[model samples]
Target: MAETTAETTDVASQYSAQVASDLEQNLKEQERLSAEIEALQAQLAALQHNHSVLTNIQQALGTSAAAAVSAAESVTKVPAPRKKTATKAAASRRTKSQKPATATAKRAGKKTAKASQTQSAAQSAAPKLVELVRAHLSAQSEPRSAAEIAAALEQEQPERGIKTTVVRSTLEALVAKNQAQRTKQGSSVFYTSTDTAEPAADGDQSEQPSA
Candidate 1:
């Protein structure tokens, strides 16, 4: 009886030791799983904080970019008002310092009136010269120089200062008007009237060619 009791006590002690070892292994496994869960949570928190930081940086950069764009547009747009103001000021100064536009117009009108009077006198003078040229041409059979015409007219009417230059210019004008034609010999121009009623070629007068 005593030997059986001792063997039963030894088996009981061995069974208790096996159960304690199994319990210790289970505690170690639980510790490893807990550590893995804690590491995963820490990594997740770090990822979330990085995402928030990136979002904030992007928002700040967008705000600054918008401000920069607005500033650049203002730099170009601001000059238009200043230019308009300067133009208005320049025009006002010119208005104060310059003469009235009508005064300048009046001076121009005076010059135009004097020019009109001169032109009218010249038109009137042309007819008198034409009459004198025609009368001389009608009386002659041979062509005569303008100087000869002027000299004859001066003898005929000596009271006037009938210039040779005036008669020459008049003869030239008659030639331009086709009322007379000119023939040239050496250095002289001679005038011949183109009319049909002059003294006949074989009548009392004879044509004298240039000597």
Candidate 2:
């Protein structure tokens, strides 16, 4: 009977110890679960704060973009002043009204310049008759008559069609200028270069008796 009582007490103590050990293990597990839940809740709070910051940033960016667009539109949509438009119209009308006169002046100036150039070209192309007569008389070795001078001129320059009267008039002009000496022989007037004539003022011994 004593052995049976000892076995019963041993069994009861073992059961109590096992129950206390299980209770301690359960409490440790509960503490671990609570720490895990707290950690998760902290992470959620941080994520919510980050989300709020991002949302605010996004909203600010959207507002700034909208303001920029509005400013650009306002700048592009501004209307020109009425007074400036009127002034531009007046300037356009003035230019239009002056166009005809400006064109006319330009045309007149061109015509005048062309006429002056043509006159200069014509004068340059046609040498003076006095110069031709002097050249002829200077080339002669002996005295020549006006008719002979005219014939020589016609032979040299067939385009001139020079006449004896024109040659006579040019010879008279050269004699008047002391560039030639005139001699009358038997009613026929002859000319010689002044270089061969006796040096005298006006070089005129006109109408010598036939000799």
Number of the top-ranking candidate, with TM-score as the measure: 2
Q: Mind giving the per-residue lDDT tens digits that candidate 1 earns over 1-211?
A: 9999999999999999999999979975875565456545645775786577557655655655565555445443433334877867755655543443434444655655576577557646754645977888877878899789989988976754566766766776677898888888976779888773344544435666546
lDDT of 2 by residue, 1-211 (tens): 9999999999999999999999979975875565456545645775786577557655655655565556445544545547988667756655665565456555655665576577558757887767888988888878999899989998987875676766776677688889999998986879998866553323465544557
| Model 2 pairs whose backbones collide | none
The total number of steric clashes, by the backbone 3 Å criterion, in model 2 comes to: 0
Q: Report, for all candidates in order, the number of backbone clashes.
A: 0, 0
User: What's model 2's lDDT at 71?
Assistant: 48
TM-score, candidate number 1: 0.34
lDDT of each: 0.68, 0.72
